[model samples]
Target: MATTLDISTTYYKSPLGLLRIGGTDTYISEISFIDHLEEGEYQANSLKGPVTPIVIQCIEQLIQYFQGQRRFFEFPVFQEGTEFQQRVWNELTAIPFGKTISYLDLSRRLGDTKAIRAAAAANGRNNIAIVVPCHRVIGSKRDLVGYAGGLWRKKWLLDHETKIQYGVQTLF
Candidate 1:
């Protein structure tokens, strides 16, 4: 019989709030805020089978990130999305922590000057959150735009990154 991917979940209290982290025996299948994850969705998924080492490692790294002890991550992540979404996410990671990019700019970098909406949608559906660096995307005309974790969280994250870069203490 084919082996099923084992999954598990736990709550992580961060500056943003409580985040739900889920993973399979081989990798993290999903990570989202409590409000973002449909009720029972994470629980149902975590029972699918043994936890993966990579996922456990991701969990540890996430804790470190939340504690502000780590800046960048070096872990394997497994997420499901379209090829275009994956491409957009790849570009998001390249943005570097503490920097911001306009959605239109990101679209152009992806070679899709007309796919701004698609780019935003891809960012909206990003499951890996900070790891994928989706928060780095901003509106071309404004300081903040739509964020799955809320605009306040977006601002806090950006400001936190800025503080870290400038050697200033973050209020959040």
Candidate 2:
């Protein structure tokens, strides 16, 4: 039998865009750039206050991220996917902030150099954005590519982290 969870959802207006955060009573299950999702998925969704504990934690970490104070996320991230995809997502967390890796490299890291397409597919399916760091996966030649959040936002995130990496401040 499968587990059934009553999901709580809320939205946060971030520097990049509006984000929808949702989870069950125990752990955060989804974080997306858009607030829109299938109606049926929202059936179990209980709208949460902006300051709910999990929502507050997510917003705080994201704020700290934009401010260059957070390099790693602390809140639990939950998602359901194939075993391969779960592995891919788990590896995404290992990518350090302020860094970029080629999708080929990510594929190789997953133990199959020929699985570049598969790796990219998994990256595309990732719903938890910043926390999962899917944007860190780039093209072979270091070109920014394949960000569901748009390449502009991807560039902004990479540039933002790079600024923090090089300690260039006075503007974010």
Candidate 2 local distance difference test against the native: 0.81
lDDT scores for all predictions?
Answer: 0.77, 0.81
True-structure lDDT of candidate 1: 0.77
Per-residue accuracy of model 2 over 22-131 as CA lDDT, tens digit each? 76655677788864667654444435533347666887898899888988888877889999999999989999878888999999999999999999999999989899
Per model, state how many residue pairs clash: 4, 0
Off by over 4 Å in 1: 1-5, 36-51, 168-172
The 10-residue segment of model 1 with minimum total lDDT is 1-10
By lDDT, the best candidate is 2
On residues 1-172, what C-alpha lDDT tens digit does candidate 1 reach at each position? 1123355665566667777677765566567766565787655654333445766688788778766677898776767788999899889889977788999999999998999999999999998878888888988975688889888878888887777777775533
- Residue 54 miss distance in model 2 (angstroms): 2.2
Question: What TM-score does each of the candidates earn?
Answer: 0.82, 0.85
How many clashes show up in model 1? 4
Count: clashes, candidate 2 = 0
